[model samples]
Target: MIDRSDGQDEVAGIAVRIIKEGDRIADIVKNLLAFARDWKEEQGPALIQDILADSLGLVEKQILKDGIRFKTYISPDLPEIKARSQHIQQVFLNILSNARHALNQRFPGFHENKVLEIRSEVVEIEGRRYIRTTFYDRGVGIPGNIRDRICDPFFSSKPRGEGTGLGLSISHGITKDHSGRLWFDSVEGEYTKVMVDLPTVE
Candidate 1:
């Protein structure tokens, strides 16, 4: 009877896991649909943390599958910003995608330092408050020669047919449209950090 009870408990654990996975997949589908729909030119107050959560939901599984450690440090009490949520989400998706690519290129296999870290905080720039979201990756950093052209249209270091070269360009434009700033800092063969600063709703 004891052995049978243990087997039943094991089955229950598996069932629970399956149910959780189903829920996650359903959430992913919902987020994807929201992401793919057309925007209606409506901008409103949005929580940056919520936008980041939705963006991560779209790519977190794949990043983990690639054996890169993902970490986040989001502060509580972050203020809302005036934004088109979908567009801001796109910018985050681009940054996360790039970070994943860079980590894969550098590691190609699991390593202790293969990591992606995202953090957020309220920052004051020019006496104005803004929420600064930063993505840092220990990956194949940007080369000096192409750093200046990284945001130029049709400029991609990726192999042929792999990239359209407009990800960063479009992200930059979107940030500007929202009165935000996007910039990058990197050291070749070491790491890359991308920061986006958007003003808080005053």
Candidate 2:
């Protein structure tokens, strides 16, 4: 039999856990609502770092639970870009989700090489400046045979019913709409690197 004080402590612990879980669920719902809404007409100056942080908050727990290491190196002075904040965040989330899937596919369990890295910096192209964000993952990468079709609508390597195949396609459209460029580099069974370049505010 436990002492009354011990029982009270246990109950308090359980109550705290329940409250924490409830708060987490609320946050997930909030993010989902934000993502599902139409932000097509709300373009403004947006900070890449803030968008990345919000996107990562949505999936960081799941990534950690999958036994994969996640890392980020965002430049301290990333310039603001003109964008629909929600749409840009969706792009970040999509890339992160793809990277997580690749890492999980390659390493079913915990492994040293199961890692994802995100880095951001400013780059120049044809005398113009752009913010370039990259996502690198050590996972089962794209095969040369189908590499060109990764962004094609309804093209997915995932098994039937597991993926709708429009993630990258939609992401590409969003980037292009924001005057940005999206591309990928990969070697089968090794790694995949995804890069997105969005023009900065003049």
lDDT of 1 at 6: 80
For model 2, residues 1-202, the per-residue Cα lDDT tens digits are 7569988999999999899767756765675566557654778999999999999999999999999787889999889999998898889988998899899999999999988999999999999999999999989999999999999977889875456677788799889989899999899999999999999999
True lDDT of residue 13, candidate 1: 99
TM-scores, in order shown? 0.81, 0.81
> How much lDDT does each candidate structure score?
0.91, 0.89
Q: Residue 66 of candidate 1: its Cα lDDT?
A: 97
lDDT per residue for candidate 1 within 1-202, as digits (tens), equals: 2469888999999999899767756765675566446456678999999999999999989999999897899999999999999899999998999999999999999999889999999999999999999999989999999999999976888875456677798789889989999999999999999999999999
Worst 10 residues of 1 by lDDT: 31-40
Q: In model 1, state the lDDT of residue 161.
A: 48
The TM-score obtained by model 1 is 0.81
